[model samples]
Every structure is written in C-alpha cells, then in structure tokens.
Target: MNPILQTTINKAKTIPISEERKAILQEFIQYIQQKVDAGKTVNLNFICTHNSRRSQFSQIWAQTAADLNGIEAACFSGGVEVTEFNERAVNSIKRAGFRVTKNGLENPKYFIFHSDDSEPIVAFSKIFDDSANAPTGFAAIMTCSHADENCPFIPGAEARIPVRYEDPKAFDGTPEESEKYDERSLQIASEMFYVFSKIKK
Candidate 1:
C-alpha cells in the first residue's frame, strides 16, 4: 500500500462508529463472509443518485480496505443517471494520498492508484448496470438516501444493502467546501476499514 494511504487507514480504524451503525454494517460483513466461506468472489457495486461523490468514495475506500485485509473483492460504483465524476471528489481522493490521472475532458475517466503494485481503479459516471460493471451476482450497496428510496429495484443484484451517507455536494461553493469533502471522504474510509477489519481472512 502507499505509505500515506496506509497511515490514513490506520487513522480510519480509530474513528468511532456508533453501535447502531455497526449493526447495519454487520449485514454487509455477513454478505462478504458468506461468499468467502463458499469460496466465491465478492463483488460490490455502490450506487447513488450520481456516481459523483458518495458512491465513488465508497467504492474506492471499500476496495482499498478489502485489499489491506487480504480479501479478494471487486468494488464498483454507479448511479441512477450519468454525470461527470465531480472534480471536488476527485481532489479529495488525491488529498487522501492517492495518485490520480485524469483522462479526457467531458465525463473524464479517472485512474485512481493507491499502490504502485495494483492496477488503478478506473472511475467515471455511469448507470449502475453499465457494461463495465458486473451484470449480476453482485451486492448493490446504496450510498445515498435518494437513490435508495427511488431506486426500488436493482436488477441482477444478489443483495441490495443500504449504506447511506449525507451528500457533501450540499457544501459545494460554501466556505467549508474542501473541509466537508475531506470529512465525508474520511468518514467513508473509516467505515470501510471497519467493515473489512471484521472479516476473517
């Protein structure tokens, strides 16, 4: 792992998670555990209204956490509609010690790297069922309330789990814009680390 990212993960493990939240996260843990015990690959697809913020953060952090814990899991993120991956979220990830390469202009593809040894996570905005993502046999993790409430059904998902988070997009253009974005990113990172920490590798 990248040294800075490893440090971030270490700090994330110390962030407090409420008992209520832990209970909800347990459901996610159980899903991964069952797959591992069955000798099956774990696939997670994070969903939100736009694949721009919360969902993107969840996908990156979850994949990094799984890798740190020696778990074999594939992580992806999508949304109900397509929009460019918000630049603010991309900046937040870079600040968290990732090496990011942006490709193209409109709806640019982001190659996010947490470690030199690993392939970069190619991130962009697209619908949940985009051809790039697993069509079936993956858990659809809802990362925002709007998508959770409105997206009643996610076809081909073996499990649909709601792990909602507040939208930092609300803070966009505010004086606390950067701060809020960083805060949300760390919160997601902490929770993701917590989830993988509970699984027995």
Candidate 2:
C-alpha cells in the first residue's frame, strides 16, 4: 500500500461510528460475507443523484477497504444523471492520500490510485447502469436520499442498500467548503473500513 494511504486508513480506523450508522452498515457487511462464503466475486455499485460526491467517495473508499482487508471486490459509482465528478470531492480524496489524475474535458474521467501495485480506479459520472459497470448480481448501495427515492428500482441489483450521506455540496462557496468535503470523505472512509473489518476472511 502507499504509505500515505496507509496512514490515512490508520486514522480512519479510529474514527467513531454511531450505533445507528453501524446498524445500517451491518447490512452491507452481511451482503459481502454471503458472497465471500459462496466463493463469489463481490460487486458493489454506489449510487447517487449526480454521482459527483457521496457515491464517488463510497465507491473509492469501499474498494480500498476491501483491498486492505484482503477481500476481493469490484467497486463502482454512478448516478441518475451524468455530471462530472465534483472537483471538491476529488480534492478531498487527494487530501486523504489517494493520487489522482484527470483525463478528458467535459465530464472528465479521473484515475484514482491508492497503491502503486493496484490498478487505478477509473471514475466519472454516468447512469447507474452504464456499460462500464456490472450488469447484474451487484449490490446497489444508495449513497444519497434523492437517488434512493428517485431510483425506485435498480435493474439487475441483487441487493439494494441505502447508506445515505449528507451533501457537502450544501456548503459549496462557503468558508467551510473544504472542511465539509473532507469531513464527509473521512466519514465515508471510516465507515467503509469498519464494514470490511468485520469480515472474518
């Protein structure tokens, strides 16, 4: 693992998760465990309205957590509508120690690297069922209330888990913009670490 990302994970391991949040995250843990027990590959698709922030954070952190825990899982993020991954969110990921590189113009794709040995996570905004994502037998992790409510059905999802997060976009243009984005990123990273930590494998 990258030393910086390892340090970030060490910090995230200590962040507290509320009892209510644990209850919600437990569902995700169980889902992954079931797949692991069955010797099946785990596929997780984090979903949000714009796929610009929360969903992106969830996907990246979840994959990193799974990798750290020696679990095999494919993580992806998408939205109800296409919009580039928010720059603020991308910066927050960089602050968390992931090396990121941007490509393309409008709705640019981001290559996020947590470790030099692992393949970079190619991230961008697209519909939940975009061709790049798994077509079936994946968990649909709803990362925002809007997308959860609006997307009544996610075709091909074997499980639909709602794990909503507050929008740091609300603080955009405010003095606390960066702080809020970092806070949300850390919160998601901590919870994802917690989820993977529970796996017996």
Candidate 3:
C-alpha cells in the first residue's frame, strides 16, 4: 500500500461509527457476508445525481476498504445523467492519498489507484446502467438521496442500499472548498472502512 493510503486507512479504522448509522450499515453487512459465504462475487455500484463527488468517493473508498480487508469485490459509480467527474472531488481524493491519473477532455476518465498490486479503478461520469457496468447481480448503493428517489428502479441491482451523503458541491468555489471536500472524502472513507471491517473471511 502507499504509505499515505496506509495512514488514511489507519485513521479511518479509528473513526467511530454511530449506533444509528451502524444499524443501517448492518443491513449491507449482512448482505455482503451472505454473498461472501456463498462464494459469490460482490459488486457495488455507487450512484448519485451527477457522479461528480459523493458517488465517486464512495466507490473508490469502498473498493479500497475491501482490498485492505482482502475481500474480493468490484466497485463502480454512476449518476442519473452524465457529467464530468468534478476536479475538486478528484483533488480531495488525491489528498486522501490515492494516486490518480486522468485521460481525455470532455468527460475525462480517472484511474484511481490505492495499492500497487490492484488494478486502478476506472472512473468517469455516466448513467447508472452504462455499458461499463454489470447488468445484474450488483448492489446499487445510493450515495445521494436524489438519485435514489428519482431513479425509482435500477435495472439489474440485487440490492438497493441507501447510503446517502451530504453533497460537498455546496461548498465548491468557496474558501472552505478544499476543507469540505477533504472532509467528505474522509467521511466516506471511514464509513467504507467500517462496512468492510465487519466482514469475516
């Protein structure tokens, strides 16, 4: 692992998850545990309105956490509509210690790396059911309430898990922009670490 990412994981492991949140996370925990016990592949698709911030962070951190725990899982992120992955969110993720590489112009692709041995997660803004994603048998983790309520149905998801996060877009272009973005990224990272940490072989 990159030393910075190892540090972030160490810090995330120490962050406390509230009982209320844990109650909700337990549902996801049970689902993942059952899948792992069945020897089934676990796929999670994080969704938000724009795929710009929250969903991206959730997908990246969830995959990282799963990797840290030696859990075999694939993570993806998408939105209701296409938009470029916000640069601010990308910066925040980089600050949280992932190495990132960019490609393209209009809707550039981001390859986010957490560890040297794992393949980089390819991320960009697109609809939830984009051809890049698995058509079925994946969890649809709603990372923002709007996408959850509006989408009504996710074509092939086996589970629709609501794990909403406050949009850091609200803080964009402000003096606290960087701070808020980093805070949101760390918050998602902590929760993902909490979720994956519950898994037992």
Instruction: Report lDDT (CA) for all predictions.
Output: 0.92, 0.94, 0.90
**Candidate 1 CA-lDDT value:** 0.92
Q: Model 1: how far is 31 from its true place, Å?
A: 0.4
Where is model 1 more than 4 Å wrong at Cα? Answer: none
Global lDDT of model 2: 0.94
**What clash count goes with each model?**
0, 0, 0
When 1 and 2 are scored with lDDT, the better candidate is: 2
Worst window of 10 by summed lDDT in candidate 3: 5-14
lDDT for predicted candidate 3 compared with the true structure: 0.90
TM-score of each: 0.98, 0.98, 0.97
| C-alpha lDDT (0 to 100) for residue 59 of candidate 2 | 93
Over 4 Å off, model 3: none
RMSD of each: 0.9, 0.9, 0.9
Which TM-score value belongs to model 3?
Answer: 0.97
For model 3, how does the per-residue alpha-carbon lDDT over 1-201 read when each residue is reduced to its tens digit? 778878887887788889988987887888889889999878999999999999999989999889878899989989999998999999988887888999999999999998887799999999999988888999999989899899999999999989988999999889999999988888888999899989988
Ranking by lDDT: 2, 1, 3
Supply the TM-score for candidate 2. Answer: 0.98
